[model samples]
Target chain A: MISDSIANAPVPAAAPNPKDFAKKKRTNRSAKLKQCKLDARREQWLSQVKNKGSKDESNGFRDSSMHERDGSDRSLENLEMRQRGEENDGSIHHDSDLESPSNSPTSNASSVLGGNHSGTNYTGSSSSSSSSVGCCSGCITEEEEDDGCLDDWEAVADALAADDKQQNPSSDSSPDHEPVARSDSLPELTNRVDSVVQVSKPECAVMVPRAQVNGQAWRPDDAFRPQSLPNLSKQYSFPMNSDRHYGRGAVSWAHKSVISAPSSCPICYEDLDITDSSFLPCLCGFRLCLFCHKRILEDDGRCPGCRKPYDLEPVEGEASLNGGSLTFRLARSCSMITRS
Target chain B: MVDFARVQKELQECNRDVEVSGIKVSPKADKLTHLIGTIPGPLGTPYEGGTFEIDIQLPDGYPFEPPRMQFSTKVWHPNISSQSGAICLDILKDQWSPALTLKTALLSVQALLSAPQPDDPQDAVVAQQYLREYQTFVSTARYWTEAFAKTSSLGVEEKVQKLVEMGFPEALVRSTLEVVGGDENLALEKLCTV
Candidate 1:
C-alpha cells in the first residue's frame, strides 16, 4: 500500500534538480540511479517505522506520543530523501490542488503509472477513515494488529488519539488520553481535520521527487511538459472510461450551510474544478461533479444541487457559463414552479 | 457505478458525529455498496430509546438517484411499512436532492418517526389506526418498537427457554418469539392471546 501511495504521489514530485530536467527525455540511465536510492530509503523508512511502532507498543504506554513523533519523523525523512525523487510533480500537484477542488489524485497516479492502479476510493480526503485500512495504509500499519479495530469504532478511537495530540500539546503525556474513549465532538472534528490533511499531506507526498518512477510512467509524456501542465482547459474532463478516477475520495460533504462556502460538490464533496467538466454548475450556481451530473442526467432531469426543475441543456445549449440562466430559467421555467 | 468516493466520504462524515447525531452508517460487508445505518428513535416519541437500523442499498445512480433504504430493524410508523419495512418518504424518491447526505436523510427518517404523516403513508392500516384511534396507534407503535426495535438484553436462547417453560410447546414458543421479534414479554402475550 505504501508503494501504491508512492506510485500515486504526483509523478514529477519533489523539486527536481535542473540537471534532471535537462536530460528529461534521456532519463533511462539517470532514472535507474534514482530508483535504487529511493527503494533503499523507502525500505529503511518502512522498517524503522514498523520497528518503532512495535517497540513503543511493547512498552505498554506512550502509543499516542510515539505515533505523533513517528509522523513528524516520517515527514522529515521524506524531505531529506525525496529531494531527488520529488521532481515535476510537486508544483504541478499543488497547482492542480488550487485549480481542481475535486482532485482525483488516484486517477492522475493511475493514469501516470498504468497497471499500478491499486485504487482506494478514500484516497485523499475521506482517507481519514483509512486508519482502519491497516494493511496498505502506511500511517496506521500497527493499528491493524493492536486492537484489530475492524469497524467504525476504529475511527472513534483514532479520532481520540488524534484528539490527544491536539489537546495537551504536551506530546509526551499521551497516557491520560488513551483510556478516554467517549467524546461529544470527536466525529465532527475528525472530518474537519480530514479535509485540511487532504490538502496538506499530498503536498508532502508530492515533495519527494520520484524521477525514475515518472521516467517510466506518463503515458501522455508530451502533454506533461511544463508548458502544457497549467493549460487543463483542453482536457475538459477525464475520459468516461477512467470512471474509477471519479471515485477517489469523499470529504465531509454535508457541512452546515453557514460555514465557509463549500469548494467541493455537496453531493460527493469532490472538488469543483471549473476547467474540467468536474464542475457542473447548475443554473442556480450550485455545482456538481461530472459523475454526479451524468447520473442525474440519466435518472432525473433536475439538478440535485439546484433544488429546481433541471434544465438539461442549460449547461451546453442555452445557459451561458456566467450563470445567466439562474434568473432567466427561473423566470420562464414552468407554471408548476410558478404555482408552488 | 455507485460513486464510491462520495459514499466513503459520506460514511466518514456521518459516522464522525455518531455520538452527537445518534446516527451511524457502516458497510454491511467488504463492499461499501451495501451499508447499515442506525438511528436512535426520537425522544418524546413512543419509539424513544429503541435504536432503528436502516438497510441502505446504493443504486448505480446514487446521489443522482436516492439510495434504497428499508428498515433492517422493524419499525412501526405510518410512513414505514410494518410488514416489509418499505419506507414511503419523498426524499428517498422524487424529492431527493444530491445536497442531502445520508446523515440528513436519516435525520429526516428520524423526524418521520417523531411525526408520522398518516395522510400519505406506506401502511394504510397503520395510517387508519393513527387517524382513528390515536391513543391505540401510539401504544401499538410503542409496543412494536419495544418488541422489534430495541436490542433485547436477554439472549434469544434464554427467551426461548423461558417461553418454553411456560407450559408451551418449544416449537410453538420459538415461533411466537420469532413472530414477536424475540421479545419474551410480547411472545408470552402473543401465546396467551392465541
Candidate 2:
C-alpha cells in the first residue's frame, strides 16, 4: 500500500513547478520501483526458503496443468507488477500514469498484457542475475521441482485415492488423465490448482494475474466458506489498468490474480511466506501468517479461522515473535547472518 | 487499522459469488473502511423483490470488531429502526466473530428480514403491530417495502406518472413527488391525507 502512495499519491497541496514536479516524481518512481523490485526478489527468496514445507504439502491442491502454463521469464516482470497490484490499489488514471513511470499501473498492464516480453521485461532491467541466490538458477530449479512435484502429486494423489475413500478431489483428478485431459479440468480446478501453482510456481512465474492467484494459498482461508478468496484469488481483475476507478481492493485482486509467489495470508491476502514459523495455525487448523495471527491475538485472541479464542501460552523453549512455533527461527537467523 | 487487505479480499470474494448469495459489497469511496452493501430482500417475506442497501462502517478493529451496518434504505421491520435505520441484530453486535465477513454478516441481516424477533424489537411500534395486528403488519410491511425499496431506483418521472395514473392530477403528482423528494409512496400517503 505504501508503494501505491509513493508511486501514485496525488500532487501536494502546494503544487510544485509542473516540470520540476514531473521530473522529481519520475526520479522518485524509478527509485521506488527499483527498491520494490529488489524487495520482491528478496521476499521471493525468503518465501522460497520459508516455504520449503509448501513443496510437499502444497502440491496436493494444485492443478498440474497450470505448471504447463508456467511461462518461465515472466518472473522479474511479475515480481515487480504483482507487488504494484498488491500495494497500489489507488486508481491509476491514465493521465497520472503518463506522468509517473515504473510502478505506474501502466507498467504493470504493459507487462501483464504481454507487451514487454521481448524488450523491457523486469529480468532485462535487473543487471544482477548472478547474485548469491543465483537468481536464474534458483528460478529454473524451482520450476523443475514444480514439474517434479506435479509428477509427484500425480502418483501421490493416486496412492492417496487408493488408500483413502475421501481423497481430495484435486489430487485424484490428475495422474488419472494424460496431460490433455488435465487441461480440460483446468478451469474447474483453477482455484485449487492456482493455490498449488502459487506454491510451486513461486520461483519462476508469479503472475498468472490474481485471476490465477486468489485464495489458493491457505486452505483454512476457506473457513469463512461464505466469502473466502481461495477460489476467486486466481482472477487478476483482467485489466490491471490504472483506471482511477479501480480501488485497492480491485488492485490486490488484480495483483494476486496475476502473479502470486508466496502462499497468501488468508486474512490480508498478501503473499505469505507459509513456513511453519511464519504461517501459524489455530487449534482448529485455521492457518494465517504470523502478521495477521499476531494482529488477531492482539485484538481479541480470537482466531479468524475458527471463531474461537486460542491458547496464548507460549510453547516450551520458544519465545515467539507472534503466535507461531518458531522452530525455524534459529535456522533462518543463522542463514540471514551468514548471507549478510 | 481496518485490515484493508482483508477487506479487499472480502470484496473480491463476496462479489464473485454474488449470484449465489445475492449480496454485493463495494467501497463507498476509496476507503475500504466504509462500504455500501446491497442485499435482495428475503424470499417469501413482505420484503421480497425489494433491494435493500446497507451502509457499513468498519471500526479500526474490524473483523475483530463487528462492522456497523444499518439500512441505508428505509424498511419497516421489528428488529430494525424505521426512523434511524439502526438494526437490532445479534451478529451486528456482541455475537459477531472475526470469522464473519461483511458478506456473511449481510447474509445474517437478510435472514433477519425473513424471520423477525418481535420479542426483541428495535422499534416497539413495529413489534407491537407485528404481534397484535398480524395482518395489518404484513400489509404495512409490504407497503413500506414497496415504497422504500423502489424509491431510490425509480426515477421521479416514473413515480410522477405512476401517481398520475392512480387518479392524482399530473401537476399535483409532480409537486407532491418533488415535496417528498420523489418518494412516490410518501407522496401517495400525503395525497390521501389531502
How large is the i-RMS for each model, in angstroms? 1.7, 2.4
C-alpha RMSD between model 1 and the true structure? 34.1
Instruction: List the lowest-lDDT window of 10 residues for candidate 1 chain B.
Output: B180-189
Clashes of each: 20, 27
Candidate 1: tens digits of C-alpha lDDT, residues A145-244: 3322111121222233345434323322333222221111343234223423432444343332223233433344443345645434435454432333
Mark the regions of model 1 whose C-alpha exceeds 4 Å error after superposition: A1-260, A274-280, A317-340, B152-194
Q: Give the per-residue lDDT digits (tens) of candidate 2, residues B56-136.
A: 999998767899999978899999999878999988887787767899999999999999999999999999999999999
| lDDT tens per residue, model 2, A274-325 | 3622333454445566766677667667667556766644532124544353
Per-model C-alpha lDDT, please? 0.53, 0.53
TM-score of chain A taken by itself, candidate 1 = 0.16
Q: Which consecutive 10 residues in model 2 chain B have the weakest lDDT in total?
A: B177-186
Error of 2 at A88 (Å): 82
